[model samples]
Target: MKLFVKDLTVIDSSVLDYSRGIIGQSWLVDIVLHGDLNEQSMILDFGIVKKLIKSTVDELVDHKLIVPAHAKFCDVMSDGAFTYVDAWREHGESIHLACPDQAFALIPTEQITLASLETYLTEQLMLRLPNNVKQLDVKLREEKIDGAEYCYSHGLRKHLGNCQRIAHGHRSTIEILRNDERDSALELSWAERWKDIYLAEHCDMVSGSELSLSRAGMAALTPEHYCFKYQAPQGEFQLAIGKSIVEIMPTETTVENIAQYIADTLAKDCSDALTVFAYEGVGKGAIASA
Candidate 1:
């Protein structure tokens, strides 16, 4: 008997590359188990599978940063309650992250990849399954679109729930309406600005800090770095990264704030009312107008 669960949603919080310092990826998960029918005359109850799988995945990774421990450019330290990371880019630029233990997953892989993650997840799920279960298969996928979309990662320390973890993100599509007409150019511009970017609140940024390298240095290869620290419901979270890759908002980095910012910005350009649909991920988000 084969049992499967499709479209298990998860948010991947991790830093995959130096250029894209921190990425919160929206993952569509699929799981399959091969096993014998139990006394209940079923491979496994769908309800049980859904509950267990969702909880396991959520508890393990959902909003936490997934760091590749063996990566040459990555160095990690942990003191039970907190984890610190320093990652250097190919050209000597770097990103530093410090957060509560619950905010990160230190993986054994040399690099963080879907395949490596799947392997790790499989090992975990296998141990939790019934003895009759023989094969466990897991698939992780990102939503793809032909039109304009942006990949971004962020952490919301103020959130009381899982979002309080220092990293998690989305691949989202935005829609802008100018006088009730779709504006592709405006949508594209927003997408381009947030592409592979990190969104942070202005209040979280350190004040009056000049952390960037000197202009006479390799300006193009080395981006100016900025540091931010804040306390949330979970614990203290700190992040340092290239200033050029960050999109700072006056308000919190929630979808509601994003939409409001867009609407207000567009309103300044014209007298017509503007509506902004800012998606945090697929199928849901906030809509605001000005």
Candidate 2:
């Protein structure tokens, strides 16, 4: 017998990549189980499957930075309180970060992929399932929509909950309206700006001039790279990368703030009439207008 669940849950995460730096993504999950009928004449209880599988997925992957331990140009280390990660791009662009150990997952692989993640989840589920279960399957997928969606990463140091994790991120879709008419062009532009990008808090930025190396390197690098650090409820966190790849906001990076920032910024360049729909994940989000 086979039992299945569709649209099980959505996980927002970040993957460290040598070529793309840290890429944020959103994945929707589906699950299937093969087993003989249990005492209840069911392969598995739907309620139990929902509760058990959802909890497992959330505990392991949700709101975390997922990195591959064996990826080249990647180095990870840990002390008592924090996990330190160093990742370099193909061209030598790099990021050095430190956060609470609970903030990220160090998978035993060379890269992060749907197939690998599915395998890991299947293994975990197999261990937890009843003896009657003979096989488990996992399907990890991302939404397919042109320009409407994006994969991005961010940190919210001041947050009291899991958002305090510095490397966690989301895959979101954006919508924009100009003078109350849907503006696909404007929406696409904003999506492009944040695609695979990191959003940073302006107050947390460390001035390049303050660092001798950054100060010296600034002259040779266009747009320049900035390093930023902060302390959150989890622990200390750090992020260093090119300025062009980040959107440094004067306020927090919540969807509420993001919507307002987009509306306010576009109001200055185009017109005072604007509405921004900023989604943190699937289904619901925040809206702002000017």
Candidate 3:
């Protein structure tokens, strides 16, 4: 017997890429279980699938940084409670992060692609499944967005949950309305601006010497990078990313603030009212008008 669930959950994370540095991504998960029927004549209860499978996947990858441990340019280390990463781009630029151990999913792969993540997820899931389950299939796919969208990475230091992780991010779509009318051009413009970008707060910025990083991480810095570090309730977190790929905000980078920032920026250019829909990830987002 086979039981399946579509849209099981969405994972929002940042992945270290050999060429692109750190790229934020979001993927929808679909799951299938091949097993014999249990005493209730069911493969697995729908409620259990929602709770167990969804929660498991969330705990593993959501709101975290997914590092390809086997990548030639990626180096990972742990000091009991925290993980440190040094990922270099093909052209000499690099990204470095240090955070709590729970903030990363170090997959044993050369790259973090859909196929690789799915295989890793399936292997992990099987270990926790019931004995009757003979096989499991995991599918990770990006949402089919018909309009302007961009991948961005950020951290919310005030968040009490996993969102406090310094390097996790999202793939989000932007919608804009000018005088209450849809504005595709404006949407596309903002998307281009944020493509594979890191949105950060000015308060988080710090000098390279002030960062809490390993010797290797400190050695990887260049004039072209910006350093950020903070102490949240979870632990100390730090990141050094290339300056060209980051957008420093005067205020917090929460979705609410993002929407307000967009609306306020657009409002400056015209007398017409503007509304901005800024998404943190799939489905849910924040809206603001100015």
* Candidate No. with top lDDT: 3
**Residues 1-290, model 2: lDDT tens digits:** 89999999998888888788778888899999999998889999999999999988888888888988888778888776777777766876776666777888888888888888888888887898899999999999987656577767888888998887877888889989988898998888888878888888888887544432222233433335677778787767766676656778899888899889989988889954898888887776899998
lDDT at position 209, candidate 1: 40
lDDT of 1: 0.77
Model 2 misplacement above 4 A: 207-224
Candidate 3 lDDT tens digits, 63-94 = 98999999889889999988889987888778
- Best candidate, TM-score: 3
Model 3, C-alpha of 19: deviation from truth (Å)? 1.9
User: How many angstroms is residue 197 displaced in model 2 relative to the true structure, after the best TM-score fit?
Assistant: 1.1
Task: State, as a TM-score between 0 and 1, how close model 2 is to the true structure.
Answer: 0.91
For each candidate in turn, the TM-score is: 0.90, 0.91, 0.97
Q: Give per-residue lDDT, candidate 2, residue 193.
A: 79
lDDT of 2 at 284: 64
Query: Could you report the Cα RMSD, in angstroms, for every candidate shown?
Result: 4.1, 3.5, 1.1
Candidate 1 RMSD to the real structure: 4.1
